[model samples]
Target: MNHAVEPIELARDCEAIAIPGGETVTLPKGTAAFLTQSLGGS
Candidate 1:
């Protein structure tokens, strides 16, 4: 017997998750600043 690792595209195709309505969610200034710092300004 053999097994193969699935590609990311395949995995994403098989999975589903819910997203909120708005394109962007408003967060408090403090929270936004913290996230920006954590993500290195993305």
Candidate 2:
């Protein structure tokens, strides 16, 4: 399955975890993130 990779800019500090694998990632405020996929239409 091919998924779209998108570049997302973070507005504030947020915490995220990797799916399929349990990995914690901390995103600081005013940062960017490369999102591969989302859940619940997120």
Candidate 3:
């Protein structure tokens, strides 16, 4: 469950899939991502 707001900053370019279309995309460095939950080996 999400309790605290997790703030993450990308250290380098990372390839990720676009959720809606499932398209492969690259997340540039310094990008921000918030994690509410983590599962598996993420």
Top candidate when judged by TM-score against the true structure? 3
lDDT tens string, model 3, 1-42?
564476699899988888679999999999987655556773
Per-residue C-alpha lDDT of model 2 across residues 3-41, encoded as one tens digit per residue: 447767888888888676969988898786775644564
Best model per lDDT: 3
RMSD (Cα, Å) for all candidates, in order, is 16.9, 4.7, 4.2
Superposed Cα deviation of residue 8, candidate 3 (Å) = 0.4
Task: Give the least accurate 10-residue stretch of model 2, judged by summed lDDT.
Answer: 33-42
lDDT of each residue in 1-42, candidate 1, tens digit only = 233343222212122222444354443332312111123342
TM-score for each of the candidates: 0.18, 0.46, 0.64
lDDT of each: 0.28, 0.73, 0.79
**Candidate 2: RMSD over Cα atoms?**
4.7
Score candidate 2 by TM-score against the native. Answer: 0.46
Q: Count the clashes in each prediction.
A: 0, 0, 0
